[model samples]
Target: MKNTTISDLKIIQIDKIKEERGTLSVIEKDVVPFQLKRVYYLYDVPSDAYRGGHAHKELYQFLIPVSGSFDVILNDGYNTKTITLNKPDKGLLIVPGIWRELENFSSGSVCLVLASEVYDEDDYIRDFELFKTLKTT
Candidate 1:
């Protein structure tokens, strides 16, 4: 796997079209660094609940808060950072080989995810210790 750190994370501003009624954001292939392969979302999560406690080996993910807000805690084996996503027109880009944990979800919050790969259990490093060890190699 390639070496990745917290520095690789990026906040992407989506292109929006404003109108008299509402605004529309567009996320085409140009907006993302990788080819879009899968899409998913999290909703109706309890305020005290936590999600995404694992890291991916080769998958890249873009997280967008389509409604309400939430906090994403990211780790790169040596450093940690927290980012709050509260807007529909902004997204957090997560590169491969980084640990992520989602928490502090407000009521009725929805997190939309765009992924670079399909679901593969083999690509996941669910154990933090194993992730750290793999990072050194």
Candidate 2:
């Protein structure tokens, strides 16, 4: 297998249009670095909350704030970084083996996540200490 670094996480912005009626945004799979296999969105949630406490073994994901603003905290076991998703045109791409936590969601926030693979429990590393060890070794 190849080594995955923390710097691999990419931030990309989509194209959006605003009109009198409403706003429209488009997220293309080809434009992103990873090929998307699944897509999901989180809505009707509270603020200052936490989500996604696990790390994937072979799944890559891109997260975007479609409606409001939020912060995504990413931990590559050895290092950590916080990325703010406030624009519908912008997204953060997360590579595999990185633990991510979503928090500080603004009102009416909609978080859309595009994944490279389907759901698999074995792909997740929930323990932080074990995640660190895996990254080092």
lDDT of 1 by residue, 80-134 (tens): 9999999999999999999999999999999999999999999999999999998
Quote each prediction's TM-score: 0.97, 0.88
The C-alpha local distance difference test score for the whole of candidate 1 amounts to 0.96
Instruction: Give the worst 10-residue stretch by lDDT in candidate 1.
Output: 28-37
Give the runs in model 2 whose Cα sits over 4 Å from its true position.
17-23
Q: Give the Cα lDDT of each candidate.
A: 0.96, 0.83
Find the candidate with the highest TM-score and give its number: 1
Per-residue lDDT of candidate 2, residues 56-108 (tens digit): 88998988888899888887766788988998888898888788889898999
lDDT, model 2, position 113: 90
lDDT of 2 at 30: 72
Pairs that clash in candidate 2: 13-89, 14-89
RMSD per candidate (Å) reads 0.8, 1.9
